[model samples]
Target: MHKALRLTALAGLFMAAIAQAATPIDVYRDPNCGCCKSWIKYLEANGFSVNDHVEPNMSALKQRLGVAPRLASCHTAVIGGQFVEGHVPVAQIRDLEKHPELAGIAVPGMPAGSPGMQTGQVHQAYQVIGLTRDGADRVLASYPADSSL
Candidate 1:
């Protein structure tokens, strides 16, 4: 009886953990962009839930979000209070969560090797940039171009 009770308690704790996890991120993307879909798939594969919206005016949205012209990407997401732009890797996303000091992160442009943008050929090296609401930018992570995967 004691062993069964302990197992039940453990299961309850596990369920509670899952229940307390973060909710689906609010995503804004153009309906006609396939790569944005791919990026969403990448997030889903990494255990993220996305509340997707087919944004009609991406340019205005990006501008309002303070995404600099040079740091442009295909999609935008809101997780917690921080923004995620482009095809940022799952690891970088988790890191951003860990460091709440950052206002947001971005992968900038559509790189060939990014999770959803992979074409199965050559991969392009890219940087995941951290951005502030005021337009400051810094490199959060750098991925070297490789096709080994």
Candidate 2:
């Protein structure tokens, strides 16, 4: 009976490792960017494993990843073959994961109370925009979704 319990525990651990290994997201940012590090911490807090890629030419990298200048952010991410631009929330990122049909999502500019750029009581209502590889964009999720803040 004890051996069976031990095996079950081992199995659970193995499965957990597999789960962690599966959802690796690549993050590209400037090496000098502090906000980018904060965003990475945010993703990690939401159970994502980030592969950091520091690129000196962030503008060129964003262009290469198909993130439109209008929807650009300080950092960019690639997850499950989709581009995620800017300081997008973890919930929105999770939603994007389920919708592979969409090319990507973006938080546009750095809002005052965004995950990475947080300050006390500073709430700038921002919109998370959905995008296609061909440059079309639409509002995907609005921050403070209810606008009660």
Candidate 3:
């Protein structure tokens, strides 16, 4: 009976982990922005489930989400209660999930070669900026000028 009970508990934990993995990331972006769509595809290709929302007033949404104007980008995404701004890479997004201390992360502007913003081999250097709960901004990751990823 104890063995059966343990098996059941383990099955339940596995199911919970699967559910967490399937959690869809909610993304808000302007309908007219092609780069936003590209970013969505990029997320999907990277195995993330996305719930896309075409927000009419993105400025208000960004302000409400504690994303400062300085971190502005073409689109915004929310996952695990943290905002992801711009074309941040998948690796950084995964890192953000591990750090609850960060309110959100951003790649200021639409830099070429970052995820969906990729322009062939034209990879420009960029940094992933993190916003703390107390409203402090910090550099989380940096991609060098010649970086292909």
Largest lDDT belongs to which candidate?
Answer: 3
lDDT of 3: 0.90
**CA lDDT, every prediction?**
0.85, 0.86, 0.90
Show model 1 residue runs off by greater than 4 Å.
1-23, 147-149
Best-to-worst order by lDDT is 3, 2, 1
lDDT of predicted model 1: 0.85
Could you estimate the TM-score for every candidate? 0.81, 0.82, 0.82
- Give the range of the ten consecutive residues with the poorest summed lDDT in model 2: 140-149
- What would the per-residue lDDT of candidate 3 be over residues 1-149, giving only the tens digit for each residue? 99999999999999888767764789999989988999999988876889999999999999999998999999999999999999998889888878899989999999888888875778889999999999999998989887434
Q: Which stretches of candidate 2 lie over 4 Å from their true place?
A: 1-22, 145-149
- What lDDT tens digits, residue by residue, belong to model 2 across residues 1-149? 99999999999999998676656899999999899999999888778889999988988888887888898889999988889998999888888877766789999888878888875567788998999756678888877732555
**Model 1 agreement with the true structure over 1-149: per-residue lDDT tens digits:** 99999999999999888756745788899999999998888887777877899999999988887777788888988887788899988888877777676778999899898888986687999999998756688888999988575
Tell how far residue 112 is off in model 1, in angstroms. 0.5
> Per-candidate RMSD vs. true structure?
3.3, 3.1, 5.4
Could you tally the backbone clashes for each prediction?
0, 0, 0
